[model samples]
Target: MEFLNDYLMIIIWAVVLVGTILIEFETSDLVTIWFSVGAIGALIAAASNVNFFGQIAIFIVVSLVLLALTRPLTKRFMDKEVIKTNADRTVGMHGVVVTEIPFDGKGEVKVDSQIWRAFTTQKDPIPVGTRVVILDIVGNKLLVDVLKEDL
Candidate 1:
């Protein structure tokens, strides 16, 4: 009982360190990485004969400092959304051919409120009133394909 009481700090530190590392691994979201490092610091302090309150204070301070320093940086790189341009916004959108688009030729397509110069993949001419999907934007033109009803 006396041995367990004397080594309680070591036991707590071991449990905290392992538990935090496991949680970090499971989540892989950087949520518990700071705490895992802090637990290691606390474990080192406990091993060096630091008292319980001092170990806890060290753990809290280290964890908070690390979290503040790295959390935003991690999120900035991880949660980045794709930057879209005015033309890029039309990709995968359905449009109607407003002018005949023959192979190796140009035409116009109206998607929503915007009319864009468009071209089609089909070798046959895509006449007016045909439904198409924007595939890509090339300079001042839109590359499009016929849209199947099921898609």
Candidate 2:
């Protein structure tokens, strides 16, 4: 009992530091890092013979202060940029219908030397060999329109 009372704050702070560091490594969210720093502050207080309540107060104050001060700056630095893909380049390009496009069903089109599943909103069926203009891609399918002259 006496040994535990003497070292209790030190043990608790050490455990908190290790646990927060492990959690920070697993998540990489820049959150638990503040708590680990807080645990370090508490550990220092305990080592310096600060009262138990004072150590707890130091931990809370340090953690909250660091979180409030740095989280927004860290978030801005961590924001990811949107990336363009090769598939995105297909929009606005022209293609030829390789299979008859039934008004209610999907069809295949040949665009830029590659074949893609295509769909159209036109009420009439599109015949094979008709020219189509790629509009947008949905999932693995392309949304297309008949070329103006093909109407």
Candidate 3:
């Protein structure tokens, strides 16, 4: 009976290790950190012939500590490497106005073979077919100024 219990504990640990790896592959929301701790604790308990209750307690405590310590560290790293989904990468590129820019509002421009939301930095309306330089990116829109050569 005792040998059977130890074998079950080891099997549980193996299952947890496999499940954690699978979950980590499926999503990147930082959910597997605690599972890793539980798996480690189970492995240690199985190797040391620790009781099932002690194994569970150790697993819970170790997982909680690891989760607490890693949560903030993972969050900080993720925050530092935030992905930008804006037109900032398009700055300094040239494009032509696809629509007639209104005197006081926004328009559209074609850059990199793609149409994008754009606006003029200057007060004057930029007519269609005029080349413009991307000056800055504001929100989802591109701030542009007329290219002197295309004027």
lDDT of candidate 3 vs native? 0.83
lDDT of 3 by residue, 1-95 (tens): 98888888899888888889789778777779688777888778887999888888888898888888888988777564646764567899999
The number of clashing residue pairs in each candidate reads 0, 0, 0
Return the candidate ranking by lDDT, descending: 2, 1, 3
Better of 1 and 2 by lDDT: 2
Model 1, residue 13: C-alpha shift (Å): 1.1
Q: Give candidate 2's error at residue 97 in angstroms.
A: 19
The order by descending TM-score is 2, 3, 1
Answer with 1 or 3, whichever has the higher TM-score.
Answer: 3
Across 62-132, the per-residue lDDT of candidate 1 in tens digits comes to: 99999999988999877857677777888999999999999989999999879999987788888899899
What is the model-wide C-alpha lDDT for candidate 1? 0.87
lDDT of 2 by residue, 5-122 (tens): 6488789899999999999999887869999999999999998888889999999999999999999999999788978789999999999999988888999999999999999999
Error of 3 at 130 (Å): 29
Candidate 2's displacement at residue 63, Å, is 0.6
Q: What is the TM-score of each candidate against the true structure?
A: 0.51, 0.55, 0.52
Q: Give candidate 1 regions above 4 Å deviation.
A: 1-3, 80-151
lDDT score, candidate 2: 0.92
